[model samples]
Target chain A: MSFPKLWSFHGGLRLDGHKQESTRLPLRAARLPERLVFPLLRRDGRLAAPGAKPGDRVLKGQLIAGGDERLDPPIHASTSGRVRSIEELPLPHPSGLAGPCLVIEADGEDAAVEIEGLANYREHPPEELLRRVHQAGIVGLGGAAFPTAVKLAPAGRRIDTLIVNGAECEPYITCDDSLLRHRADEVLQGAELLRHILHAERCLLAIESDMPEALTTAERALREGGFDRIAVVPVPAIYPTGGEKQLIRVLTGREVPARGLPADVGVVCHNVGTVAAAYRAVVLGETLTSRIVTVTGRGVRQPQNLEVRLGTAIADLVAQCGGYTDEAERLILGGPLMGFALPSDELPIVKSAHCVLVAGRGELAGSRPAQPCIRCGACAEVCPAQLLPQQLYWYSRSDQLERVLDHRLFDCIECGCCDVVCPSHIPLVQYFRAAKGKAIAKQREREQADRARRRFEARQARKAEEARERAEAARRKKENLEKSAVPEIRQAIERARRKRAEKTDQHATSDTPGRS
Target chain B: MLALLAVCLLFALFGLLLSYASRRFKVEGDPLVDKIDAMLPQTQCGQCGYPGCRPYAVALARGEADINQCPPGGEDGVKNLAELLGVESKPLDTARGTEKPKAVAVIDEAACIGCTLCLQTCPVDAILGASKFMHTVIAAECTGCELCLAPCPVDCIRMAPVRETAATWRWPEPGAVRP
Candidate 1:
């Protein structure tokens, strides 16, 4: 096994991964929920315009919405059902904001439309394959939810390496780990296909050392399949190691330039699960309808790894885990570190769902009165991106947006590492987020201001031209009057002066109302 | 001289072997203890039904603690710590404190008499302003643990919830949207 160069950054909190319970449970298909609340917006922030209204019949895997040119991946009906309602509902957002959602009541028939399959991956051109990928509505399953085709489309640059991220570094996330352990062949085949599609020279699969079984299984599959170009690289088990940039850095010893992507470094990283989804899309012509979710928490009565369909309700998934052991204090949608707390279990799962944690009262209990920053350098030591989280925190706390940007606040992934390790228990991530938000808003504001200024300038120019035209017409009229024998000059001047005075008064009042 | 040298060499060799044996035979405690300690919100707040971050880390290492004991860290912290320590993270320990969206210390400027009581009591120096001037909270620094809220004699300090923006927006968990 090749040892990837992993760095120990400034600040990182070592959290309990809590993966053993679910890791032991083999992947099981979850029973379909009575109702699946399929969200129209599956890709990042952009929602697909709903195609079907309430009471419309839709088939399983049928594209319900999304025709925006802006990378809006189609949202498919997870199950054959009647469109129960098209209404604004609270998504699994951290802020608990409501977004447009499609509610489907399952008719109990697990029906799917006949999908057209390509004979082999080699038979199709790259553009055709990319189109199929887009049609399948496959997005980055590694939580970014970026449209997959956009990622596969080659830029006007040379590509050399394809990094397969199997880090599964986030705690409580065992879906990728389980997938690797169970379906190594499919993952390798997918990697091979991705290599062909991208026309990449070599592929590297990076997995953490802690997952020995997955590492061994994947390695064995690669060797048996004679995939010499693909090498299984075992990296140090570190939190956020699975992050695309970090994983790329570990495997290739390259830093994805700040504000740049892996492709910028001549590398494209795809999650192992995402590659599997791609393969399924290319080979089976199946759209991304289901995914593996690690369902485990102390509050859960039966911890298990499940292959659940998209739009399955958290309540139903939790029910399959033998229900909550006690009144769940907090229900999280993803792994704890990056996951958001669900207001209730009624929310349906999206493609990004990897783990659902039902936290119990005991688990939910904690106290650390926010204290002053002791200037502990713990945050700098564990930062996977080698960023100064503490400094960013300092600038952010002061609302010094300029200083925050100077410290590369945009590079901060908001992984919550600094906040987790702060001796003062400061919400470091929130501060950085607020600061970044302000910066983005400020930029937008500036752009809008520029636009307004331009518009005003245009209006002023128009007014000036109109004034010139009026003056010229008045001059011409005076000249013509002077040329005429009976010139009514005094009356014309009086009328023009009165009109000018009225216009000036109106302009002055509108312009300096406060001054007046 | 040769006898003395041999004796010294033998002693050195014996010392090295002893040290190696001790290291090899020593029973290793939980490696996750330090990691769990590190992942803690580290507010030093005793709201976790424990004394401090270190004590909770020790308890977690000993399997005497639940992963979700830190309310200040909220659900995300619990999940993260649970993931790190290789244990099943529970929900926020609601008995100690309910897990709500994070809030920060906010001083009501009108009500505050500038007593500086809340300022001194603040753990993270989140409350700003010198004595006799109107105090304001550095909202970013405030952990929203409500430590400063209790110290204000005039009831001027309030826990203001942090507002969400496009930057702080996270992908909603799967199945979190209800019809």
Candidate 2:
């Protein structure tokens, strides 16, 4: 069948599709680990305050940590377990730092909390759907882990299309594809629900053209479920095509405004995994406790996708996949292009994790000393965000933050397309990331300075006002005393005059008698 | 002779226009002071030997104070000021105080004498308390100025260093590690 005409983004790479090894086997349930360590911080690095204390028994799907509705979503227990001590633990981060995590020891019963699914989700208003999505703690599972409810609301923007991203553009990440193959109906149901919530005219599910099985199954599910408004479209299997902005551009010939969101372009995009999770959340009334994780790489003995619970340690997943091979040289979370090298296997998985790639020695690109930029302009040619990576690198290296900002530094998506094309191997994305951090810090400092300046000025004005009022009060008191004293002095003078007149009259009479 | 008179009248007309333009666009205050104040970081700390950031800014604008006297602004701050004022950047004047890491004061509520000394001393009014009641510093508002340390009779306040976590972690600036 002929698909509709598709638009293209600026620059992308055609990397080796190392996806077959994982998709060869069917999806399997992961073995439960003895302990699950849930970091109190969300994937975006904000704290999710713990609601369950130590020693408290938490059932599966129970809320363990609570967070703000929009930015931070509440975390739920993946399995029935007793709360262990919440303390500092190694986290999955490029910095290899530690954060506060809620530890839970599995009770082995695997019992779940009582849940009630909504039978008539269609009747509920869009606000109710967003509220349920927020309570379910569903985030963009394609790896940003941004709160889904916030994206769905659109803040009064008119949405014409909803893009369900199934591209799974990153190599070796087949969790989304496997979800489509197995639960296409649920995914389609989610698309329909999203369409209803958005009141969009059309819903397009964009899958990679390479995954014919996923495309067919999703289309079939669309027909069987009678989701007439939803269409399954196949996009080119190019690296970084699955990015929110890139996918939106490919699906619709529109550009989301810089520093804005997809909603700004009259569209809202969500990962296919996030859409399915939303369906389950609103219909089944189940909170997002577990997700499908792909454990694959040349370093692992068995490479396949497993439905794993969140907060499961990396070591547990590796063991469940028959443990790491002898050549397992490094553990990288997500994919080779954008993922970071994890420090240890003890770090627990969070919502954003899609793949745990344990690469063998020389399996991926080895680090080399970066040479000075040759100014080949190749990085600029391949930058998906249409940025001058070379200029950004120069400014970032010299700590020229203002110039970097003037170059539209925030628009760089860090998709590694420029890094791949850079002949100097400058690690361009790292410089951009560091520069972005500095810029944000600079902005925050400016804000604080402005705030402090305002407060100081306010205080000065208040003190000046108080001094003026005090001076005015003192002057009024002096004037009132003078006013009252003037009248009293006048009465005293009149009385003195009368007394003197009386004395003079008496003297006059006595003098007259003497004179007579 | 006629040409000379015409030239004189034209000069007079141009001079009148210049004066009127200047009066129409008269600036209210010293813009140099505002520019210097904007770069001062607004800590309100008197480490510069002035009463506050604005006073120091005024002094700098008036050529009365050096640009390196602010300890909170640090070396970078000095560099920015130097660039702004077209002066050579100088090292921080350590006689005032050495630059310290950003930190906020935390009052030990138990030991707080309820003396309100810190409350009265806080320039920003970041501390919230009444007479005979324990005071707490709003960390977001506190500029990490240690002026409150001197006034506390019971020594309840201490500067707690901010911890770096995944949330607060910044990608470190790249250093030269070339082989």
Per-residue lDDT tens digits of candidate 2, residues B1-179?
99999999999999999999999999999999999999998999899999889999999998999999999999999999999999999999999998898888899988987899998788888899999987999988998888999988888999998777787677765563311
Where is the poorest 10-residue window by lDDT in model 1 chain A? A448-457
- Model 2 agreement with the true structure over A1-516: per-residue lDDT tens digits: 234789999988888889998999899888887899998876565677888999999999999998555778899999998998999998887778888889999998888887787769888888988988998999999998989998888887999999999999988889999999999998989988988999999999999999999999998888787877888999999888998899999989899889998998999999999999999999999999889999999999999999989999989999888899999998999998889888789889889999999998888873766888999999888888899999999999999999999999999988888888877778888899999988888888889988988888888888899999999999998666656758886677679889999999999999998998
How far out, in Å, is residue A434 in model 1? 2.3
- What would you estimate as the lDDT of candidate 1? 0.77
Evaluated on CA atoms against the true complex, candidate 2 attains a DockQ of 0.50
Which candidate tops DockQ?
2
lDDT of 2 at A280: 95
lDDT for A16 in candidate 2 is 88
Identify the candidate with maximal lDDT: 2
Deviation in angstroms for A280 in model 2?
A: 0.4
